[model samples]
Target chain A: MANTMLHINHIAKTFNPGTITEKKALLDVELTLNEGDFVTVIGGNGAGKSTMLNAVAGVFPVDSGKIEIGGVDVTHLPEYKRAKYLGRVFQDPMTGTAATMNIEENMALAMRRGQPRGLKWGIRPMEREMYREQLRTLGLGLEDRMQSKVGLLSGGQRQALTLLMATLKTPKLLLLDEHTAALDPKTAAKVLELTEKIVAEQKLTAMMVTHNMKDAIAIGNRLIMMNAGRIVVDVSGERKKNLTRAEVMGLFEKAAGEELDGDRLLLS
Target chain B: MEIIKLINALPGCVSQGVIWGIMAIGVYITYRILDVADLTVDGSIATGGAVATVLLMAGVNPWIALIVAFVVGMLTGLATGIFHTFMGIPAILAGILTQLSLYSVNLAILGKANLPLNATKLELLISQRNVRALSLDNPLIVLAIVTAGVIALLYLFFGTELGCSLRATGANNAMARAQGINTNTNKVLGLMLSNGLVALSGALLCQYQGFTDVGMGRGAIVIGLAAVIIGEVLFSKIFNNFALKLLAVSIGAVIYFVVIQVVLWLGLDTDFLKMLQALVVAVFLAIPYWKGKYFNKKTGKGA
Candidate 1:
């Protein structure tokens, strides 16, 4: 059995369809993730990593495609309708938290997503303890500062919090779109480490898009490179383990029929 | 001083203040909380007032009319929210379109450009006259009711799951979504609740003013923004709690009205009201940036 947590088949997305500005952001794309599969996606700007994740999340209608999670077809579902099956962390740290709300309050929101969120279960003591335990796992000393506004948290802390939020319900898949690129080097490393820890602990099938080739190779079980709206390379198993930055660059060049452009792939 | 005359007009100003202050709270919901500026409030306010007046004229109980006005306002808000989230309309543009459409809707409901309630025959405020014992114009009683209603609602809501999701949608729609919160639904609900309150304010306002003019909601969003800015600037430290946000906004409305009244008393022509409103908002809006840059240089805090 495939045991796939997610599958994207024959997906295509065209922006500004039929207009002068019409652009093909994603051309016929196909991918599948076995349960517990940790996949890293790499691409140049406009190469469709984000677009693929967006399609899976149903941000907008895919020009053409079928999306399935846990054997359920969701090609026609909207973003909100599909939310119960997926957790998404945006590229912007600021995009994942409410600034004025206290940390616990923010978490409470994340904890209650997709359910009929109501006043009856507004973070009881047990839930607070649960949140504290989750925060403690992050090892960011956030357990003690549950009342602090999330705005006060550093980018790394917020990203980590977002990671926890994404996995809170153990959805079939978690979509992380360069969730740590904006942070400082130290913070990025910490968040990435937390990302690894949570995915392993939860055994979640996840797709993370990263600009950092080193981290991509270092973190996930599989790595896919894309250029010109299609997957250029997909590596996994022992092959993925033996991959290096140079080999990945070579694959990109082969797929694009060109030399690797000036280094935009984050090297850390 | 001219300020005393402004103070004498305090009730009228505060009455207007609370009315728009509630609208400000509505604005704050969309603008500050939901990170949306649902201009539907401008129309929703008139909608509320129009509903209240029509129902009152139809011999509905005053309180029932108030509730109906709120429901009508919420429907208007829902329309805007649905357009923005489901239809993919930008928030600002969505609000503008809804506001424009509401003008026709309001006229349709009122059967004309406006509706007027005969204040004398209407049930006055409890403070102005005892319901059974006395007869006095009771705008203050209604003011207290609105103030109390807003505060209670805010307190009750911020603690709810749906409510928190709504707040998170404003703060971080992505986060809200990742956590299983449907931001679109929350945005729609938040806008509805916000404009609903604003509509209530409008309903009461029309009753208090004895008339509902088609143009009464002109620049309503600005007034609401002004009240919210002023309140946050003046009471940041005092009302940091979610429960206090509504009260602070109410006071902001009162303060805004008082300032306008004072200016009007000082021989400034009423024609300058709009200009003065802009200047006041501009000054207050600059405060945070000013404090962040200059004042904070020494004190280590933003304006």
Candidate 2:
């Protein structure tokens, strides 16, 4: 059965009104992710990739339109209310983990997502073992440093920790907003590989926004390219499989009717 | 050469320092741990004292009255967090709003410009005058009670599931949200706890000083911040561990008190203490950024 994991319909966002600086961040944008859909979103700067993620996450009230996850209408819900159904990671390494907390504690927080919190220590003996096994999957040897404060970890290590934490609850949809942008090139590649392995293993519906075109083509079952606050191109299956860096760039130029000048997008 | 003399002159230094220590613990939760500047401490201290004294006047038990003060403090803190998280107000403005409102609340509770608790309220812990023969003037006994209570509570609270989430929220709110921890709730909770503790200290101070003036909390946030920053810079240098920062903060409060005596003995105007506070805080706050930006590569590497 092809169950839909997420649906975005006719969403539009405009900043400021009756003022000189009104700018629209998203416009009549529509997107849908079937169960286990791994959609890679690629666009240049101001392409509304992050804004779209923020809108879906309810960072704030969007101007209009509907967002559904697991067939439930969640467009007007606050971020905290919708949190149980979605897991997220941001671009900055520092944004995703409490730097002062131990690695194990961070994992426990993610594991207990949406559960009633209390004054007791969050992680127990059984939970510790579960966290260790999960950390092992990263192959980053973080299990041995469970008690170590996460702030001490390198950028790559923190991002890897974030990925594990995000999927721990098996959220209905996972949002990764340039989750690897802060890492060095080599570490970013490694983390991306880990992202794929985990997405495949969990079979979780995922949306990832990235600037790198090769990663855009290589990582997911579907590719979505956005520009001027709209989904400019959508590719899947055989067409998506053969997507090249050059073809993605050509479509951006054709849809926007101008050569892209910003360094926000990588072109070959 | 005169450290011992400085300690002798500031008889209330230990007890006063401990009270400041509790407030520092609050400062720590919001500023150091949460990474948000909260200006509510100034109003909250007065709010705690006012609530406690008012409750005592209404015939509430001394201990129970103190708890009431803490509750008021929490509400004030919650208001501050709500401003930032829900109303989209800047964090500083959010704190300022709560702080301004707390001023009127304190005035109403006191029923006058100040509330005198020495005539009305019991000492925080009932001391047995003959049990150990330690006089009321003994600073060690005072420090002992306050320190033990604060350390135990902080250790217990920060170790809990909610506490870790609070710390994580301050450390990185986005990550806290990613993990399904509500940063808004945590922020509000953290402010409430921080101000709650600060006001509890204020209640203690009122009894210790004989009164809770409407302005007693003036410049208090600065004093607490100075103690906290001084503590972190000195302690992190030696302990080199995250968990030990609490202990370091306690020691820092003690050091700040001891230094106050030295400044007093040097004939520095008591009125100028606030200026001295600003200087000390400026130095320590810059220490970490300096150490990271300059000394880390030159001297060595460690956080």
TM-score (all chains, Cα) for each model: 0.89, 0.89
TM-score of chain A of 2: 0.95
lDDT per residue as tens, model 2, B236-296: 6687554467667767787898788888887788998889888888887787788788966
lDDT winner among the candidates? Answer: 1
In the range A1-268, model 1's lDDT, one tens digit per residue, is: 6598888898999999899999899998999999999999988877888989989988888888788988999899767768888887888988877778888887777676667776774677788989999899998899999999988998888888888877877788989999989999999989888888888999889999998888899888999988878998999999999998889888888888988774655444
TM-score of chain B of 2: 0.86
* Lowest lDDT block of 10, candidate 2 chain A: A259-268
lDDT by residue for model 1 (B1-303), tens: 655665556667766787788788888888888877678887889998888888888888888888898899999999998889889999889899999999999998888986667756765332212212223344666567767877787877777776777777777666666666677788888888888888988887887777887778888888999999888878988877776877888889989988888777878889989988888888887887987787558776443
* Model 1 chain B weakest lDDT span, ten residues long: B126-135
